[model samples]
Target: MPTLVKRLLAALVIFLLLVVINQYMSKEGLFGFGVPSYYARLIVLAGINIILAVSLNLITGFTGQFSIGHAGFMAVGAYSSAYLTVYYAQAWERSLGGIVGGSLAHALIFLLAILVGAIVAALAGLIVGIPSLRLRGDYLAIVTLGFAEIIRIVILNIDSVGGATGFTVPGYANFLWVYAFAIITIVIVYNIVHSDAGRALVSIREDELAAEAMGINTTRYKVLAFVISSALAGMAGVLAGHYLSFLSTNDFQFIRSFEIIIMIVLGGMGSLTGAILGAIIITFLPELLRTLGPRLESLLSSIFGADNIPASVHTFLLQLANYRLVIFAALLILIMLTRPQGILGTREFGLSWLKRARRRPEGDKPVGTGGVSIAEQEPPSAIDRAKEVKNQ
Candidate 1:
């Protein structure tokens, strides 16, 4: 088949799939198969987290960098995007409203804003990755963390972007936009990891010195991974900022960075599937706890009789919901102790599993007499030759 034909077919298939996904996810459905509004929001948030986690995985998992300031790049994306949408969305509404209408005009406007954010974030990645090339392990971690703090502080002091008061973003981003970028992020990261560059990245992770000794440009590849990861994190930040319709420096604080790191760690550092799984679990866990806490408190109150319970106890019950981080931390500790490799542990689930099943394991070859490899021995040409060999 011609390459052009193959490319066209692939493009067509992707377009169709995107259309189908958009329809199914929309409030109105083709076959009455629309998702509920509440679940839809969760899915969107999960998609954003997935992008964040997967990008982080490329740097930390595949490239063997232990960065903890990912949230800083996200902050760069979020604030820049938010600023554009909030401050400049009216330009779109005023100029393009007649052509694209209010909604789509705003979306296009914000999409451009998001691109700016992503670029800024990628540049920030270069800023951090380049200066700290000689640093490794905790030293690099500290540098990244410092960079994130610097970003947050800079945002906090920027009077035009709401300063410490924070900025309100237009609600231009939705599930469709979020999921679209998420899928793009996954595809890009997956392709990078599966390519020759990915091997070099992984080799750097395995042993930087050895990879360098083999003539691999370790610093360049590491920086490339950093920039890509940072850009994707920025994209995630853009989605979040637009979705929430607000932005605060506090929102992109160090803890947010840690949460992203935790997601990658919990999901399995090097596995895309693991990143996704970790993202889902991490994103939903707080909601679950917050929801469950009240129900459990009500059950306890009802069972024990409300009159018998002290006001202090009631207050404590309410506060229990806020301890989700503590609960999450405990769970993380348990996971580390039991399955240190994470849920997937650098493994993925796909057609590759089927391929593995079909091939015999390298260690499974049969050993003949005197430890000879049966695989290496050829059979007799004829039955008479076999008989003569047996007689000998």
Candidate 2:
């Protein structure tokens, strides 16, 4: 089968799976049980994180730039979008009596906010990239890290935007908005990565001097990639802010940036499918761990006997809730030690193993056996026959 056809089929299958899952979630319940709202929130978070990871991969992974301030761009987007939505929504409500006054009007407002977020974030990327892209390695990382801290502090001091108390955004996010934007982000990044521009970015990653010698205009491509990545991060922030209906300076701190970096590293830095997988796994893992706390406590109690189990054991388990960051750091370190290439390495899931598995013919010979036809076989030469006779 043609590669295009195979890719289309795989995409169709993924789409179907997503549809089925969404339908199931929309129904009465799961296994005769009602799923909590927090699970849905987790799914939304996973989607947003996927966007962040995949977008950052374009810059840090494919383009070979070190960026540690992604959350700063996200902050720009969140604040910009929140400001537009809150102030405009209020103005529109006062003039037209609510978002329902006209669907078109409501949509226009929403689109305006999204565009503002993207533009603001892209500008922030440009500002940071102009000077920082001149540096490399640890220098660039430090510059970006400092930039993120500056953004946090600036937001903290901006009183009109809610200052230290934070701002309350209107709840306007749903599954539709979150997943639609996520899909858009993925599609845009995917197309860009496969384009000629993407080849230029990859060239820079391979060797900056070599790319420059080849007249590839490395700096231009680097800035472009950074801007695009930052814009997507901003969009993700907008989605998260709207969904949660709250925004705080603390929410976009450096720790959030580190979390995103960890996801990209753990997922295989250059692979989009890996980014999505990493995002989902990391997002749900903590929730899954939380669920196990009670079971672990009970198991320990049984093993040690209730009398032997100290009250501090329960207290310690409760403290595990506060130790999530430590666990995340430990997991990252373990992954780095055991599999530095990441869960999927630098290859995409759809590009290698999955594609091979799906496309292999049922009865085909093994790939490297060299199954020559009898007609192509040749008898031994006269020299060989003479040598055999001499040996005998």
Each prediction's whole-model lDDT (CA): 0.87, 0.84
Using all chains and alpha carbons, the TM-scores for the candidates as numbered come to 0.81, 0.80
Candidate 1 lDDT over 1-392, as tens digits, reads 99999978986787678668767877896598898877778878888999999999999999989998899999999988777777776776779878978777766787788899999999999989998856899999998999999999989999989999988877777776887788788889999999999999999999999999999988899899999999999989999988888888888889988989889888898999999999999989877877766787789878998788788887877887789778878988999899898989999857765554566676875688555687777774799798898999
Please list the Cα RMSD from the true structure of every candidate, rounded to 1 decimal place: 5.3, 5.3
- Model 2 alpha-carbon miss at residue 367, Å: 18
Candidate 2 wrongly placed segments (more than 4 Å)? 1-34, 93-104, 298-324, 351-392
lDDT of 1 at 164: 91
Task: Give the count of colliding residue pairs in each prediction.
Answer: 0, 0
Residue by residue across 39-94, what tens digits does model 2's lDDT show? 87788789889889999999998998989999999999999999988877667655
Which model scores highest in TM-score?
A: 1
Full-model lDDT, candidate 1 = 0.87
